[model samples]
Target: MTDRTPGEPTGLDIALQWAELPPEHLKAALQALEPELARRHEMRMLQARLEAQGAEDRRSHLLYLSGLVGGFLIVVAMLTASVIVGINGLPWLSAMLAGPSVLSLAGLFVLRRVDSGTARQVARAHDAALGAAQPTPGAGVV
Candidate 1:
């Protein structure tokens, strides 16, 4: 890391010194800087919030896809077991097959519902963030 001394003159300080402003002028400068700095910080916070929301949306989508794939695989397994039972004349496997298949399908249904809800929420958040970032007409223009 670069060495940074406390109370060192930064670029802004040097520029201010070059301008040779009085002490009261310096205080006025700081007052003028405050609102612009606060607005910049607010913009950064909004960006971070949008990023977090996008990440959550991606995670939710992945979970929904995995659940769908898993449920499909379970269904295939059930079908395979049914075929095996039919060929081998085994009656007990049928009961074993129904339970997990039903549970997996139910879980997939719930996951799909949740994923749809999350998609809507993500869309709303994206729209809101975009709206917030946009400059309004006749605002903030010198």
Candidate 2:
């Protein structure tokens, strides 16, 4: 751990020192700081919201891409099985098609589930942040 002075400057103290204002200016300084601080807080919240939204979008896109690729591979496998059956026999055709079909279905199911769960989580986080940022009725009003 690092050592700190007993009277180390807090954020307000640092701001006051930087501004070279006297103690009598405390109230005015705080009044000025309020809106600036509120704006900074709002910016941070917006950034968080954007990040969450971006993550959800990426997950959705990934799920869609995976499904598309899986479907393509399954179709290719079916065509290959048909060709092999026509050339040699049906003995190995079922074995060749079964694996790809089962894997494609399972992958699609998993991707859908994961995407929905991530979406719900992001939505809940956004709602919670929005609710917290808004004041309750009659609050902070004289």
Candidate 3:
């Protein structure tokens, strides 16, 4: 029987308890245990994959949020510099600085919009790849 509780002996412990068994019986027990061991190994692999995906998703979300925040900060700093330059009587320089800020903000807005369509884009790309990989109906038929 398998262990079911924290204080209970583990499978290895139970196997060790059978160390005194006759050689034939020990070989038979090991053969019977093989399928359970393989199943447990598969379950652990699946759990690890799910956990890794969850962590990757969280890291990606954080990176996206950091990018948006960094973009906003850069725009704000550029506009502030533009205003300071204007007040100090450099009209052309102020306009030059402000132009890029506006462009940067627009870029950030477009990037934000693209995030919403990413899933559709990925699915479309996957479908396109699958379509390209399939052979044409008449190309190979004689």
Task: Name the candidate that leads on lDDT.
Answer: 3
For candidate 3, report its TM-score.
0.58
Could you list the CA RMSD of all candidates, in the order they appear? 24.1, 25.0, 19.1
Clashing pairs in model 1, backbone N/Cα/C closer than 3 A: none
Best-to-worst lDDT order = 3, 1, 2
| Candidate 2 lDDT, 75-104, residue by residue in tens | 666767756764764544444444334444
C-alpha TM-scores of all predictions: 0.60, 0.49, 0.58
Model 3 stretches astray by more than 4 angstroms: 1-4, 7-9, 16-21, 105-142
Q: Rate the local accuracy (lDDT) of all candidates.
A: 0.64, 0.62, 0.69
Each prediction's total of clashing residue pairs, residues at least 3 apart in sequence or on different chains, is 0, 0, 0
1-142 in candidate 3: lDDT tens per residue?
A: 2325678666677678677897787778778888877897888888889999999999988878887777777777878898998799776666655753345454564365444365555546555544554556999777
lDDT of 3 at 25: 76
**Per-residue lDDT value at 131 in model 2:** 59
Model 3, CA-based lDDT? 0.69
Rank all candidate structures by their TM-score, best first, as comma-separated numbers.
1, 3, 2
